[model samples]
Target: MTFVHAGHGATMLFMLLLLLGAGAVGAAVLSRRVIGLRILDYPTGRSAHARPVPKGGGLAILVVFVTGVPLAQMIWHHTPTLADKTLLAATAWLGLFSWRDDMHPMPALWKLGAQVLAALLVAWGSLGILPHDGTAWGMLLGRSLWLVVLCNVLNFMDGLDGLAAGCTLLACVVTAILCLHAGAGVDTWGTALVMAVAIAGFLPFNFPNARLFMGDVGSQCCGLVLGALGLHMANLPPLAHGWALMPLMLSGLLADVGVTLLRRTMLRRPLLQAHREHIYQMAHRGGMQPATITVLAWAATLCGAGAACALAGGVIGLPAAAGGVLALQLAWAVVVIRRVRHTPGLRW
Candidate 1:
């Protein structure tokens, strides 16, 4: 028992150090060239910051995360897990493709193809599109679809500085605590620790008026990592608690993106066009500062994720917990939308 505890502790420490080091290196590279490149300039948009800032700093976070996973596998003397390796390969490719798009805007079809391929890679390799233990193909398909949708939702939510990172950090921390209580293995804990550290190191540079934006590299990379982790947690044996908790953990983001897309579609608006229609953006437009909006969103995420962890631990029933959280998030969204609509100077 003591040996197990020590090993877990060491793994967590190692992951944190690896992520921090990698993030620092990525940030340094971006800080030097990010402002000067202006390769694929960020044009003014509705939700855009007052001034154009260097984007693609997320490549730094991606660099640190993708490289650190394999390095940690070797250091721990454990064979690289199949899920981890598959996710890394897919995410690396996705990051590269996104970075390419960021450098030179690609056609919509090409971007969609890349996202599909990346999603398929994870579905085939990690989640195994065919269900096991009598689970139906429909169930497997639903899960895979959820993975892809969630990945895109997170990517869409990356409009504001530090928003995605802050939300992801909160989700990871909650997941880590649940996994720890459930006696999850070192790999699970290590993955969470690394993500926490990476986001923590990157947040300072990203918050408020960011010096650098995460861009495509960071957003897609993070989506992949979180998606992969969500699958891993859900696949854990016996209880498979992650499935029950996922909706709550992701309630805020899922609600925001889903509602925005649905609302846009209903109004015959182009879904793919960049816009400042998210609830967070609306909150900002409604006399709230960016930082205040971010904090409110983060606080809501923490509550939802905490409720998810508690439900997963069997302290609370899943349905009631998930439904309650969802209701709260939906209410928040409706209020934000109403405020945005009524506010005289608000732009959506």
Candidate 2:
């Protein structure tokens, strides 16, 4: 149940730096005015921006991941496995659909269908990677659903600049740390670091100021990869109790997306219909700066990560960490609701 020791710290460090440096350069090139003109995001009634901007900056991250991972495998003297190819292929499939959607808006049902198909691919691929439990069918269904939900959750939370991307970057970094602590192989932790730097490549243009947007292409890819990695970790025998790692790390995103969708359903609002009603969106509408809101979300995620790490270290049991996470989310919801209470036209 243990992993090959992740030796060659120097080599790992070089790989990380190479990915980051390349990603940053790619992001810079993609941010050029001529390049951005290829796909523009025009402001709508529900949009946070006031003008059209270049979108699809997430292409840099996608490119970095697609190339960086294989190179890392080579550097580590590990052969590329079928599972690795499956993961990349599925991500590319979903990314293609998302790219098309960003360039020319597609129907909600169609996008959802694409996401489901990609999720199924991931589930099927996981069967080979994860150790067999008796309930294979159950695992397949659950993993597929997990990927789909995360894909949509991140897509929903991508309303403001840097919100989704920044949060995901944080999750990747923390997940890598947790993976190392749990004695996971270099494949697990190293890939997580690659994802983190990939996102870091895109953040400079999207955060604080909106020079470019990641579009659906970047957001959905981030979600799918995150979901896949979380499932992989959960199936690791040594990390059996680490099942809650991702949820705890992404508590802010899950809480915001979960509550918003539930409230919409209760109010008879169309579930897939786009709107600016998320807690973060509501806070922004209430005059809070996007940077401030995103930072708050980052802080919540960091808190959750700390608690989750405690569970990983056996310092606290799963129940204790899970309870603390729930309490933290509830407190966050309360504070956000109170802050935006007086914002006109907000139902909650």
Which candidate leads the pack in TM-score?
2
In model 2, which regions exceed 4 Å deviation?
A: 1-16, 33-35, 129-134, 345-348
For residues 207-245, could you state the per-residue lDDT of candidate 1 as single tens digits?
Answer: 876877777777777777777677767876533467756
- Give all candidates' CA lDDT scores: 0.73, 0.81
lDDT of 2 by residue, 101-147 (tens): 98889999999999999998888887775536658878788889999
TM accuracy, model 1: 0.87
For candidate 1, list the clashing residue pairs, or say none: 58-214, 58-218
TM-score of each: 0.87, 0.91
Q: Least lDDT summed over 10 consecutive residues: which range in candidate 2?
A: 1-10
